[model samples]
Target: MAPMGIRLSPLGVAVFCLLGVGVFYHLYAGVISSRIATFRQKKTVDLRELLALSIEASVQGGREVKRIREDDSLQEKTKGKTKEGASEKLTLGDLNSHRKMFYLFKNTYPFLQVNSEEHDSSDGEATIWTPNIPVDVLNKVPASQMVPSESVTVWIDPLDATQEYTENLPKYVTTMVCVAVDGEPVIGVIHKPFTGHTAWGFVGQGANVAPRESYNANNPKVIVSRSHSGKVKAFVQQAFGNSTEIIPAGGAGYKVLALLDPSDDEKPDVYIHVTYIKKWDICAGNAILKALGGHMTTLKGEEIDYSGSEGNPGGLLASVGMDHKKLVSRLPPWDQNK
Candidate 1:
């Protein structure tokens, strides 16, 4: 027993050393798993060809989105035909019209994934593209069946600016492809196909025009809806106070890009998804924002968790400036029913 109290024997010493190594390996394994988990959670989407096709179709089909937008009665008739009896709201119009266009474009442009179910209400629509995992299919697949833990995962907001598109505002509307590495965005491509212009951004990797600067500077620009409601306007006013400059952009994607390294020097410093900001509304933009060393958190400063739900909480708040604490602080509380 080697005096029982003091184990000086070689066997005892070896056992203790082995235990230490085991503990170290356990911790090391945990770290590796964390990195792996982060990587797997990263998300992205590719809309280059699809966007071009959409625009091309829009060139012929653009008249349709615009036609319905201008003729309220046409919209009402289209929605009334739906099983859900959608209202005249822009989002509903978008779903019904796009659903129609999908059928129209299917024979000619079969690549746009028109067969997927329409997951829109009076709020918005969520469609699936087959090339990338259909959201519905992704929901069914277990995490284990997904790519390796070190691989990246992305969610495509195929038609991000549905409202803008429905409103005949392709300038504000855009298509995006964003990729994230280890839960942080690294690559982003936002294309305003109508104008044949695109803005790209990167993190730890910089873009052509985006500077490593605060998100908000003088003349702080804001992208707002062309058809804003009084309630939303009042809320925005309260949040930013008077003398705030707002630049109207057609789509949420345009708004997000406007906040940071905007294609137009007149882009805004902040992007606010005040009401009904669905997951599709912010997914691609979130990928880009995070890529530029920026963040899109809830008003209370909590990191938003995507890949878990298609419905996002209320609206989102984001900025390229780290000093955007005021936004949350001055937030005008809202209701979910809206």
Candidate 2:
């Protein structure tokens, strides 16, 4: 006998080999997916961590502003200068001592990137910025690198309404974070450190309207920047004139939220504004607003595109209610006096 020749079924051998390959491929895919998921989780954690750090930096800015307001020595340097001319005297270089804290906290993060609207960002980016507004961390963030599932652009006016901050307005200054996706806000967080109060809105995610003390529904309120004035007040007066009460608050982020929520007992139906600002000013906050089932657009009801050049500035008209069309019709465009 020839050592009893052994026979194996070709089909069975082939099936076993295929099964082995399938198992290996499945494991390889699982590992890859797992790694991707882990990366996303870590990124999210990092963003939140960054948010906390930003809050710290914002607080520092607030303190600096307060000192400017309280310091007779510093105020004397800027005494002759009007609030409009305050920036001439105020320089980031002068705040080097104060800004060091921001630098220190900023360096701790490995993936930190400048928000395009940073004062030092390219001229095109900064051109859109309104005077006296501090670009928050999100303003410098590159659009290409945001979280994948939900694209976001954040506006961090670390010291929003800076003029007020420098003018001795207690708690008039604030730190803001507006989260927007493709031009709509999905979530937003605004903190008034002076009051130790926080307000958050997550579209469809249920808003907490934090700062328990800040939550009220009796008298609706609207916040506005301390320095810039005109169309916002006119629109409010014409829209709500006798029907609703208008409470003017300072800070764009704060104002936007005021319409979403009011510290008074009643909430306003709409928040409207017409001004020249860049994508960095409202992108993040708009994301949060959109998430809350609201909409923001130009007075013409056209969507504001972030891709435009700085010269083509876009203004906003946001509404928690869909009453923007009526309001738009009633008010004149920024260029035209209605």
Best-performing candidate as measured by TM-score: 2
lDDT of 1 by residue, 161-221 (tens): 5555655666675544444334444445565545655555444434433534555544355
RMSD of each: 16.7, 13.8
Q: What is the TM-score of candidate 2?
A: 0.55
List candidate 1 segments past 4 Å from native.
1-153, 178-187, 201-219, 227-229, 261-265, 335-338
lDDT for position 102 in model 2: 35
Clashes of each: 7, 34
Best by lDDT: 1
lDDT of each: 0.51, 0.49
Residue pairs of candidate 1 with colliding backbone atoms? 43-153, 43-154, 44-154, 58-62, 172-250, 215-321, 221-268
- The CA lDDT at 19 in model 1 is 96
Query: What does the lDDT read for residue 10 in candidate 2?
Result: 98
